[model samples]
Target: MEDKKKFLADLRAIWRGIIGDEGGHCPCCDRWGKIYPRSLNETMARSLVWLAHHSANGDWVDVPKRAPRWLVRSNQLPTLRWWGLVERLDTEDTTKKHSGLWRATKRGLLFAQNRLQVPKKVYTYNAEVERFSDELIAIEDCVGSFDYSAVMESNT
Candidate 1:
């Protein structure tokens, strides 16, 4: 049930910048689902943020048109639904086959709100990969000295 009257008030007091354009998800922030290494970490982090956002705020609400554009391109929506973080419903909106009707289920809300926890691990392997870093690091003269051959030998 969308309380039209309280919507603005509620958001003003507690908007977490989770909702993206179309207003149906929570975007990643605050390092809630952070994993080192940006290329591989973004999606993982976004999924966690989405779940947590929905779990914390389970209301009949939709994001306004002013939402961020990243949501439109995010794959986490389908991924989350597929993984049961949110429930999907068939919509008659023609523009989309489904997604007209969606709601964060109890499980979604709980997990997102962090009433539960998903056990996980992040192993950081510090290996120096040639002097092949960006200009900033080069300028700073930052170099990690490690035996690359030993690491490669272990893998082989």
Candidate 2:
């Protein structure tokens, strides 16, 4: 029983690390969105279960939020009850007089990073990627226009 309890607790913590409770616009896609930490927790649970069965030797698993219904349904595994706990841990106003959106703080991000033991791969472009892309475009321009038909003929 003790072992079972510990496992559940560890699972829950892992979940929290992935789907952070804080809400923010997805920095990557720039789609305005919100994710409750509980939702993040749910994602982690599903991902870990998948990883356990599919590839034992792999060090990382990629979990994408593919279904909207999964998030909307509160009764799903990990439960809204856990979300309530997340709210308590991260929220400032119990009454929610402020905004309902809960932004992830630096502390929250660090906690998730440390607990999950996985690097957070943000999709948003950093300055370096942007600079490199710009340079590539300039190089392409300098090469002058290439005939598309010529290239296609060479392939044949």
Candidate 3:
């Protein structure tokens, strides 16, 4: 129970570090904006969180599966509810199908890169997660494991 609490606390802290606090008006517009306190709405805050989560390797499961996991693990609403924010930012439909797999549209990528405004802490955390993923791959290489390179060769 203690470990779970610590993990949740760490996750929340990491999220807060990535996405600024809710309830603050947009610094750019200085208008009172509707902030997402429960991670359900489309706001700058949720965008950063989505960007960080999606940027991690092997985390690109389809929205249906991935969104529920995020909601369950984070105890917050699914990020898909915030897709409108991305659409608004890009003014385009970011849902695309590539070889039967749904992928981000070009506009989605642009929105993530330019509009998310992920904080330094979030960037650092993503870097660490990526490094961890690389380390796992290296360890697997050392074990003489059969490479499944052909399975998703077209993906690259």
Question: What is the lDDT of every predicted structure here?
Answer: 0.37, 0.30, 0.34
lDDT (tens digit, per residue) of candidate 2 on 1-156? 999999888865654444344434443465543332112333533322232222223222222233234432432322322211112123476785433222222332222222222212212222111111111111112223433332223223
Q: How would you encode candidate 1's per-residue C-alpha lDDT over 1-156 as one tens digit per residue?
A: 469768766763343332211233223233332112212124433443443453344443242232235654564455444334566566668887555234556655544443433322222212211121121111011112422242223223
Query: CA shift at 16, candidate 1, in angstroms?
Result: 44
The number of the candidate with the highest lDDT is 1
Clashes of 3: 0
My TM-score estimates for the predictions, one after another, are: 0.36, 0.18, 0.21
What's the CA RMSD of model 3 in angstroms?
16.7
> Which run of 10 residues does model 1 get worst, by summed lDDT?
135-144
TM-score of 1: 0.36
* C-alpha-based local distance difference test score of model 1: 0.37
Q: How many backbone overlaps does candidate 2 show?
A: 4
Q: lDDT, candidate 1, residue 128?
A: 16
